[model samples]
Each structure stands twice: as C-alpha cells, then as structure tokens.
Target: MKYSAIITDIEGTTSRISFVTQVLFPYAARQLPAFMQQHASEPAVAEQLAACRNLMQQPDASLDAIIAQLQQWIAEDKKATPLKALQGMVWQQGYQNGAFTGHVYQDVFDALSRWQQQGIKLYVYSSGSVQAQQLLFKYSDFGDMTPLFSGYFDTRIGAKREMSSYAAILQHLQLPPKQVLFLSDVVAELDAAAPLGIGTMQLIRDGQVAGSHTIAHNFNQVEELIA
Candidate 1:
C-alpha cells in the first residue's frame, strides 16, 4: 500500500496465458534451431551460447550440444537465463516477420497509463529475457507500451520463486521491500515477496486459486488497491 515501485509478472498477469503458451512459446520453439544456425557466428548469439554452456557446466561444449540442450530447456520452459536469452533472439525474428503482436488485456493498458501518471514506477519481472519483455511491450497490442515501464528483470538475477531474487531486486531498485508491490499470478512468487515485506497481489485471470494472497480479477481491481 505504501509502495513506490510496482513490479509485475508478464504471462498470465499482464497478458493472457494463452498468448504465451500458445503463441509465443510455440513460435520460439519452432524458430530457435534455424535462428541459432543462421546466427551462430554472431557475437550476441555466441555469447548466449557460451552462457548456456556455462549453465550446463560444460565449458568446452560444442555448438550442436549447446543447441540440443537449449531445445530441451525450451520444451520444459526452464527459466535459465541462457535459454531465455536465446528464446528472445528467436522470438525477435517471429515478431519481425509478423507472427503475432504481444497480447495484453485492454484494461491493463488503461490501468498502466493511469498508474504511470500517478507516479508509481512500473517494472517487469518475468522468466522471459529482458529483450523479450521489451519486445512484448514495444510491439504490444496497445502499441508501444514500453515507455510505461521503469525497468525489466529476468532469470539472470535468480529464479522467480526464490526469495533471494526479490531481495536482489529491492537492492537494485534502492527501495525497501515494504515499499515495493510485487504482482504475479503465482502464489509461490507472492509468497517469496511477502516474507521480504514486499506487498503482494495475486492476479486471478483464470479464476483458479492456488495460494493465500490478495487476489484481483483484473487490472481495474489492482488499480483500486494501489490507489
């Protein structure tokens, strides 16, 4: 209630889960192999590949091995930073080719604008890479909503369900946890934030209850709570 920063999850909270599971994930999975093959020599692509190798603890990993491991991670939706970074690259191609624009609920865009005007800083915390998060808002259904956000954080900091990640974010934001509101559809994520004294809001977009937290069915309800 006293927060100056509002951090939110992307999939299922700000955007429909279907857009991620059905559209975004599938597109990334389908295009990853080809994208990697084509850009393997590029510095950015090689950097992510090296990160993936480091994650796998195979410092001398070959490109083919890294690619195969990344595919496995993609299928599992692993929140590994390297996997997410690679997915962002593949998804960039999809976005550029007009596969699909990011999907966000109408109410979300309106509420975000209102909150921005009220001086509450907005940030995103997602399993998706920072690049992917930017792409989502930049190419959002509402068009170019990236400016609404103050910053983005991804798995590079730590896993979403880890309390340490919340602590790290608070440190980075230079704000006390009590003054930061963390929103997510997952109760475990809220649980992680709550113990750190961060305010918690559970987004119940699908009408499913999984944890003990304040639940808002839509961004309108969220706006009222923050107000």
Candidate 2:
C-alpha cells in the first residue's frame, strides 16, 4: 500500500547515534547550568524550570538544586520532558553560535528529498522536544531541512515506545494507521507502531541486532521498501 505520510525517529535513523550521544548530549550537559542561570527569568525557560521543580517534588527548590537534578537526569539519560525542553534551549544557543551543525546522514537527505517530491508528508517523532527537533533539522548539515517536515512530535505527546503515542500522532495526522509509515532504528519502537497498523521499518545502520520487522541499512534501502 502506498503511504500518505511518514514519521521518522531522529537518533539512529536519519542521524548517527553518536551525533546525539557524543555531540548534542555533551554540549547540552556542559552548557545547561549556565544557560539556565542566564535565562531562567524568561517565560519559556521559567516554565520548564517550574516543571522540573514540580516533577522533582520540590516546588520550592532552589535554582541551583534544580540544576543539579537536571544534570543528574542528563547523566542518567532520563527522558523527562522538562529536561528535554531545557536541553533544546541550550542547543538553540549552540546552533546559533555555530558550536556544531546537526548531523544527518547523506542518504537520508537524498531519500527524504525524493519523498518530498513525491508529495508524501513528512514528520518527526522523537524523544527530544519539538524545539530540539526543529533546531536539529533547521541547523542540519544539509542546511535548513525544517521545510521538509510537515510536523514534529516529542514525548510531550507520549513516550516513543507506547502504542498510544502513535495513536495520538495518527489523530494529529488524520491519516489511516496503515497509510502512515514510521521509521526507527529500535525494534521496540517499530513494535509499538506496527501493532497500530502503521508501517514499520527498522534502520540497522550499524550492529546486527535482529527483529521481525522490515529492516533497512540506509535511507536508500528504506526508500526501496516504500517504493
């Protein structure tokens, strides 16, 4: 069946996992405390700070205390929404200052471009905040890839491994589950979407972990599957 739209994961799919774990994560960790100290009064920044405090059950938590908890979350690779949002804020500055450009695989660029030309709506659904998602694509190596996507979803919608998350995305997309293809490198994520009848493809860019779902080594291979 021809797909009407496609939603893709970021790390390990369109981009190398190291780009996130090595480049982005470390940058955010090193920069977050200072960034928050400087911008905590700003509304968006304050909102997430308040969220962090609430989630940590420390409504009166000192800014420094909250920052410490956030750093712990970073070290633990926690997927807390406030932490992701704050990281996005930090990353926005990094991207603007040219600390780094987002890493996107070359074949991903080509195949996504081709699919755009074919009139398939594209989207991103990542554990990263929507702001982070936009920042990555906007400051991507290929330059201004934000235009290629129709929308973005983050854990704010739901966790990546939850069927309810894909169900919610389908609501926003207003497309049949079978008509939306979801691409990810993790089999659990593919399993989540597949049960919802969304087409699932795993991107095995590196190791030889196995899954029953369809697998692709690169975007070129992924394109062949959908073609």
Candidate 3:
C-alpha cells in the first residue's frame, strides 16, 4: 500500500467552508438557547455546560451565562472542546429534522470512496466533535458516507497546530508516521504533522499560498500526490 491510512480535515478539505461557517454555526447559534433550556437537566448537556463554565473559570456561572459564552465562542470561531461538543448536540437535532444535509465536495466524495475500496484506512480529524464529524458524513449530501471512515477525532485528541497532537494520533493509529498521509487546508496543521513524519498535503481550494507541504487543488490532485 502506498499509504496505510489517510487522515483528512473536514472544513475546506473534504467539505466547503461555507457549509460550516454559514450553515452549521448559524443553526447552532440560533437553536442553542432553546436546546439548552430543554436539555439542561440531561447529564450530557449538563456536563458540557459545566466544562464551559470551568473553561471560563466561572464555576458558578448561570445557565444564561453559559449560553451567552457559547454564542460568543461561536462568533469568534473558537475551538473550545466544550463548545464543539454542544454544537454537535445542537446539530444532531438539525440533522434529524432534515434542516440540511452535510456538504462534501464532488472530488472529495469520489476520492474518499475510491480510497476506502482500495483498503486505505480513512479517518477524520477536525475541530468538530466526533459526533459532529459523524453527523456530517452520516447525513452528507452524498448520503451516509460515515461507514467510509475508520475512526473520528476532535480537539480531545489535541490541538491541530501542535506537533504533539499529530504524534498522539500516530500512536493511537499504531502506524508509522511515514505511512499515514494527513491532509488539511491549514499550513500550520500540515507543518505540525510533517515533522512527525506524516505525509502532508495542503488543499489549495482558495488559491495558493506557498507552504512547506505538497499542494493539491482537489482530491483528484491529491491522488496523484499519493501515487
């Protein structure tokens, strides 16, 4: 196998940034207050609310305060784990209600399916919670592509820009870094993975900026890079 595994980013890699920024984030922001009010007593929602409070160093923060804090995080595009978890919970409702299907680029859709059939283990690493990542593929416009992925990862694994995070993922996958390819649109993320010996590719969907990693305009180009 040219590569034993392929790990990919979601936004701007396999999917468009507009889907996350314009759709998912706004949906969560719109429904958060109601979602929190209805689910606050539930253990899962409560746990994340508590985590948000702790992250803000406000142990006694009220439910309203927590809601406000989350809205702020959404606006800032912060990658706070607790915020991501809550957004996933909110998005679960949206997906179940047929609000919108997840968007995956055509090139990515074809490449991911082809790679999976070729026995390259596929994984997702995104700021989105694992639940959110699964939801995207599970309800993708292409329909239920979740089975293509071998696993999912989020900030709980570690921050994407840190070399140690990629090292941790390599350890979990139990694969040599050189045999795993990591694809992302962010240069810093590619930089982090590259030093760990992971093959790195930057998606140049929004035109190119010079970077240390190999660049691909789309997943078809990435296939060429890997081959």
Score candidate 2 by lDDT: 0.93
TM-score of every prediction relative to native: 0.95, 0.98, 0.98
- Top lDDT hit: 3
How well is each residue in 1-227 modelled by candidate 1, as lDDT tens digits? 36698999999899999898899888887888888889999999898888888889999998888878987887797788888888888888777887899999998999889888889899999999999999999889988999899999998888899999999999999998778898899998898889999999999997768578888998999978876
Q: What overall lDDT goes with each candidate model? A: 0.89, 0.93, 0.94
Give the residue spans of candidate 1 off by over 4 A.
none
Please identify which of the two predictions, 1 or 3, would achieve the higher lDDT against the true structure.
3
Model 1 lDDT vs. the true structure? 0.89
User: How many pairs collide in each candidate, listed in order?
Assistant: 0, 0, 0
lDDT per residue as tens, model 3, 8-68: 9999899889899999999999999999999999999999988998999999999999999
Ranking by lDDT: 3, 2, 1
For residue 155, give model 3's deviation from the true position in Å. 0.4
lDDT of 2 by residue, 1-116 (tens): 29999999999999989999999989998999899889999999999989998999989999999999998999899999999999998999999999999999999999899899
Q: Predictions ranked by TM-score, top down?
A: 3, 2, 1
Q: Could you tell me the TM-score of candidate 1?
A: 0.95
Q: Kindly give the stretch of ten consecutive residues in candidate 2 with the minimal lDDT sum.
A: 201-210
What TM-score number comes out for model 3? Answer: 0.98
